[model samples]
Target: MRRVVIIGAGLTGLSAAYHLRQLRVEADVLERETRPGGACRTTSRNGFHFDLTGHLLHLARPESQKLLREIGIRNALRSHRRRAGIALAGCVTPYPIQINTYRLPREIRRDCLLGFIEAHLGKADSDTQPRNFLEWVLSRFGDGFARHFFIPYNRKLYCTDPAELTTEWVGRYVPRPDLADVVDGSLGLYRKRVGYNATFLYPREGGIQLLADAIAATFPPVRLSCAVRSLHLGAKEAVLESGEVVPWDALVMTAPLSHLAAMTADLPAAGRAAAARLRAVAVVNLNLGVRGPAPRREHWLYVPEERFPFYRVGIPSNHGAVAPPGCHTLSVEVSLPAGAATASGLRERCLEGLMELGLLRDAADVVTVDEVHLDPAYVIFDAARPEAVSTLRDAYRAAGVALAGRWAEWKYSTMEDALWDGATVARRLAG
Candidate 1:
C-alpha cells in the first residue's frame, strides 16, 4: 500500500481525503490550525456568526453537485439569485454596471454608454486581442465602463495596476454584455442576469464550515494542530513541529504555494526563485454584527471609488441565518499587498466609509467587531504567472508533492473549484 499524506485540512484537503477513502486508499491529514476549514471556518461572536470572508458556492459541475449530495449537505445549501450591486458616483446601481448603468448619474451614464459605442464601432482586429487586463477591459467593455467600474474596482480589489495583471483569470468571472444588452442596460431595460455567479448556493445555517465538516466526517480524523515544520522532499518525508517524521509515497499540499516553497528544505534554487516570483494581495476582512436590520436589501455592494477603504461590502445576514434575530452582519473587505502593514485606525475608516455610503446608520449601534487578515487572499495573475506557476508545479510534482486548491495552485477560484481540485488530485493519486 502506498502511503499518502495531505497538508492543511482545508476544503481541498478534506475533500481529497474523503475521495481517497472512497477509492479505498488511506491518507493522513495534517492541519496547522486546531480547527478545520481554513478560510471556510465560521466564528460566533455575541450571537453573530462570521466567516473569514464571503464564501458562496457557485456549483456548475454535476460532479460538485453529486459530491454535495453524497456528503449530505445538498439540502442544507440553499440557492439564491444574486442580489448584488455597485456603489459609485453617489448612487447604487445593479451589478455588471456595463448593462445596468441607467441608474447611475446622468454624466457617468453618458460616459459609459458612449464609451461602449465607441469601443464597439471603432474596434479593429488588433483590439480583439487584448495583451493585458487593462486592454481587455478597454476593448471588451470600453473606456467608460472600464474607468467607472472595472478599472477602479479591480485595482482596489487586486491592489495592482490593471496593466500589470493578466487576462487568464478573467474568463467567466467578468461578464461581457452584448451591444443590445449594453444598450438595454443604459435604458434600464436589461433585467437578465449575465454571469457565472448570477445564482449561487450558500449554507442555510451554520456558515460554510458545514460543508467542510460533513466531508471530514466521512474520512479519518485529521491531525489537528499538527504543523509541518519543514518538508524534506529529497527524502520524501515531512517533519512535523513535534519532530514526527511522516513519510509518504505522495503528498498533497493545500497550503499556499509560497509557504510550500519556503518550508521545503531541499528545493532547487530555480524552483524557489520561481515560487518567489508569484505575487498576491492580502485581504483585511472586517466582520461586524450591527444593532439593526441591514440597511440595504442587496446582498453585497462593490465599492470602486478611492474614497472608500473597502473594495466590497456584504450583508451576510441577507443570504443566511448568520446573524441574531434583530441584528445583521456586515462583511467588509479591504485589499493590500501581501505582507503589507495594516494601517492604524483602518477599522474606524471602514466604518466611516460604510456610513458615508449609507450602509450604516451609526457606529454606536455596532455590537461586535471581528477582524481577520488573510495573506495571499488573491493570487496576482501577472504576465509571468503562467510560466512561473508551471515551473514550480512541475518541479514540486517531480518531488512527490501535488498542489491543490486556490492557494496551492496559485490562482483566483471559488469554493466549488476547491472541491473539484481536491477530488481530481485524489483520483490521480489513487490511480
Candidate 2:
C-alpha cells in the first residue's frame, strides 16, 4: 500500500480524504488546529455563534451539490438572495454599485453614468489588454466609477494600490454590466442580481463549520492539534512539532503556499526567492454579540471610505439564527499587510465607525467581543504572482507534493473551489 499524508485538514484536505476513501485508498489527515475547519471554523460566545469571517457557499457546480447531499448537509443549508450594499457619502446603495448607482448621491450618480457612456462610446481606442487592475477598471467602467467605488473599495480591502494588482484574479468576481444595464441602474430600473455571490447558501444553525464537519465525518478521523514543523522533501518525511517524523509516498498540502515554501528543506535558492516575492494581506476580524436585534436588514455592507477602520461589516444574524432570540451578531473586517502589526485601538475605531454610520445605536449594546487575526487572509494578485507560483509549484511537484485549496494554489477562490481542488487531487493520488 502506498502511504499518503494530507496536511491542513481544511475543507480541501477533508474532501481529498473522503474521495480517497471512496476509491478504496486510505490517507492520514494532519491538522495543526484543534478543530478541522481552517478558516471555516465557527465559535460560540454567550449563545452567539460567530464564524472566523463570513463564509457563504456559492455552489455553481453540480458535483459540489452532490457532495453536500451525499454528506447529508444538503438539507441543512438554506438558499438566500444576497442583500448586500455599499455605504458611502452618507447613503446606502445596493452592491455592485456599478449597477445600482440610482441610490447614490446625485453628483456621484451623474459621474458614474456619464463615465460609463463616455467609456462605452470610446471602447475602440482603449487598451484591449489591460496592464493592471486599475487599467481594467478604467477601460471597462470608466474613470467616474473607478474613482468612486472600485478604486477606493479595493484599495481598502486589498490594502494596496489598485494599480499594483494584476487582472488575473478578477474573473466572475467583478460584474461588468452592459451600457443598457448601467443606464437602467442609473434610473433605478435594474433589479437583477449580478456577480458570483448574488445568491448563496448558509447553514440554518451550525454556522459554516457544519459543512466542514460533515465532510470530515465521511472519512477516517483526522489527527488534530498536530503541527507540521518542517518537510524533508527528498526523504518523503514530515517532521512534527513534537519531533516525530512521518514518512509518506505522496503528500497533499492544503495549507498556505508561503508556509510550504518556508518548511520544505530541499528547496532551491530560486524557489526560495520566488516564495519571498509572494505577498498577501491579513484580516483582523472582530465579531460582536449585540444585546438587541440587528441594526441593518442587509446581510453585509461594503465601506469604501478610508475614514472607516473596517472595509466591511456584516450582520450575521440577518442570514442565520446564530444569535439568541433577542440578540444579534456583528462582524467587522480590517485588512493589513501580512505580518504587519495591527494598529492599536482598532476595535474601538471600528465601533466608532459603525456608530457614525448608524449601524450601531450605542456602544453599550454590545455583549461579547472576539477578535481573530488571520494572516494571509487574501492573496495579493500582483504582476509577479504567476511566475512566482509557477516556480514554487514546479519545485514542490518534483518532490511528489501536491498542492490543493485556495491558500495552497495562492489565488482567489470560494469554498466550492476548495472542495473541487481536494477531490481532484485525491483522485490523482489514488490512480
Candidate 3:
C-alpha cells in the first residue's frame, strides 16, 4: 500500500497504525472526536473515573497479553479475580448461576437442578440445531434457569425478542453446566469456577482507558476532529467534514460497516438497504460517585431484574482506588431502544435502582452521577445480521476497501478481538 488511510482512531485504528509503522508503512489516522480512544474512553468527574462502558482487559490470549506489555502498561495492569454476580428476584446469586445455584432459595435451586437433570438425560435434547438463542439456552439449561436469568437478562440487554435471534453468536461465551455441576450446585456443594472470564485484568489506575491511551501514544499523532463525510471508493479518496479531501492507496475504516454504505457512492441499492437493517443496542452508562463504602466488594454485577433500568454494573472503584478518599464509585450500563426516550429521567431511574438494590444507603450519599451514552454498543444478531454483515464486507472488499475493529466487522467481540482485527488487517494490507 502506497498511502494507507485509517478511519476512527480507536484501539483498532491505532493498533493498525502502530503495526503499519513497524512495517515502515506510514499511515494517516482520522478521528472525528477530539480525543483518540473511541469506545474505550475514560473521563474523570470530580474524584471518580468512569469508562465509556464496562471495559476490562482479559489477557486470555497470549498475543493480546504481548500487545499489552508492548504498550508499556503491563505493570500498570492489575490482575483481578472475577467476583461477578447476578441480581434476580431480589437475590444476589453467584454468576454462571449454574455452579452457584447452591446459594439460591431452596425451591429455585431445586427447579434449576431438575432442569439440568432433564436436559442432561437427553429427554430435552433435540437432534436439530437450535433455531435461535432461546432454544439454545433451553436445550442446555432448561426452562427453570431460562425463565429466571437468561431470558430476562438478554431481553434487557438486546431490547429484542430472543427467539427471533439466531444462536450463531452464542458460541459458548456462557457456561453450559452438565449434570455433575448442576447437582452439586443445587445441593449446596458446588465450587467449580465457570465462564471464560473467570480471571481478568484491569488497569490499577486511570480506569480502563489507560490501555487505550498507552496504545494511542505509540502511534503517530492522529488527525482528530476529522470525520469522513463521503467516500469515492473507485477513486480511493475520502471527503472529510472539514472539506479536506484525503487521497489514499487503501482505506481502512473502523467505523460501523453498516453505517458506511451511505457514505461510499459506489455501493449498490440492495447493499445499502441490508446495511440499514443492521441493528445494535445503544448503551447509556451512568457513573455515580458516592460518599461511603461500596455496596459490594465484587467487581461488577449482572442485574437481570426488570425494575432495574440497567443490565450490568461495574464497580470501577473495586478495580482500583479510582475514587478519592472517603468515597466509592459505581458504573451502570442501560440499554436503549431504537428511538431512545428522553434521558432526563434516566438519572432518577438509576438512583432509584441503586437504592432498591441496597447499594446506596440514601440519596444524600450521592456525589456525582455521570451519564455517558454509546450508540450501537452491541450488535443485535437477528436473521438479517449475517446477510447484512456479509453483504457489507463483500462490497467493501470488492472495492479494495479494508475494514477493521468490532464495529467495522459487525461481530460480537471483546477488546482483544478488536486489537487482533486491526493487527490482522494491517498485516494483510501491508503484505
Candidate 4:
C-alpha cells in the first residue's frame, strides 16, 4: 500500500509511525488532541506532575521493555517493587487480596482459606467456558474470595455487575495464585509476590508521560486537533472536521471502535450495530498535589469497599519524585457509565473518600486538585462485546483498515500491548 495514514497519536500510532519510518515507509499521524499522548499525558502544576490515570509501566514482555530502552528511557527509568494494597473490613491489607487474607478477621480468614482450598482441590479439568466474570471467579476462586474482593472491587471498577461482563479480557492481567502460594500468603508467610505487575518501571521524572514523549520525538509532527469526521473506504480518504479530505492507500486507526464505525461511510449494518452495543466504563481522575505525607507509604491502593466512590487511588510520588520533595500527588479513578456526563460531586466525593481513608488528615492538607475526565476509560467485556467487536474487525479488514491500540481493539490492555500491536501491524504492512 502507498500513502499510508495513521489515526490517533497515542503510543500505538506513534509506534506504528516509528517502525514504518525505520522500514523506509513514509506515514502521517493524525490526532484529535493538541498533545501527542492520549491518557498517557501528564500535567505539571506548581512543580507537581499528575499522571492522567494510574499509568504504570509494567514490562511484562522483554521485547516491549527492550523497545522502551531503545526509545531512550533506559537510563531515566527507575524500578520500584510494587507496594499496593486493598481496602477491606475497615483496614488496608496487602494486595492480591485473595492470597493476603491473613490480615482479615479470624472468621474471614478461615472462610477465604477454606473456600480457596476447596476450589483448588475440586477445580475439575472441564472444558465448559465460564458464562461471565462472576462465574469465572466463583469457579476458580470460590465463594469467599469472590464475595469479599473480586466481585466488589471489579464492580466498583466497572460500575456494573460482574455478571454482565465476559471473561475474555482477563488473559494474564489478573494474578492467579496457586494452592501453595495462596496458603502461604494467607498465613503471612508468602515471601514472593505473585502478580503480573509485582515490580514496574517508571521514568525518574516527568511522570509516566515520558514514555509517550520519547516515542513521539522519533516521529514527525502529528496533525493535532484535527478530528476525523468521516472515512470513505471506497475512495481511501479521511474527511477532517475542517473539511479537508486526505487520501490514503492504507490506514491505521487507533481511535475507539465506536468512533471509527460512526465515521466510516458504507460499513455493514452488523458492524454499526456491533459498535452501538459495545460497552465501556468512563473514568474521572481527582488528581491532588498535597502538602501531607506522600501517599508513598504504599504506591497505590484498590478500594473494594463500597463506602468510597473511587475504585483505585495511586500516588505518583511513591514511584519517583513526581511531586516536590515531601509533597505527594494523588491520582484517583472514579468509574462511571459509558458516555454518561455530569458527575456533580465526583471531585469532592473523592477528596472526602481520601479523608475517610485517613490518607488526608483533613481538607486543609490539600494544596491543589485537578479533575481530569477520561470519557471512555475501560472497555467492559460484556458477553456481547466479543461478537460485536469481531463483526467490526471483520468489516475493517474488508475496508483495508488496520486497528491498533487498546481503544481501537476494544480490549483492556497495557502500554506494552499498545506498543507491540503497532509494531506487529507495521511489520505486516511493510512487507
Winner by lDDT: 2
Of the candidates numbered 2 and 3, which has the greater lDDT value? 2
Assess the local accuracy of residue 404 in candidate 2 as a C-alpha lDDT between 0 and 100: 93
Query: Per-residue lDDT tens digits of candidate 1, residues 31-64?
Result: 9998899989988878988999988888889888
TM-score of each: 0.98, 0.99, 0.96, 0.96
Cα lDDT tens digits, model 3, 163-247, are: 9778877774888767887887776677767677888888787787787778788867898989999998788889999888999
Worst 10 residues of 3 by lDDT: 117-126
In candidate 1 the C-alpha lDDT for residue 75 amounts to 95
Which clashing pairs does model 3 show?
A: none
Error in Å for residue 394 of model 1: 1.4
Candidate that would win on TM-score: 2
Per-candidate total of colliding backbone pairs: 0, 0, 0, 0
Of candidates 4 and 3, the better by lDDT = 4
TM-score of 1: 0.98
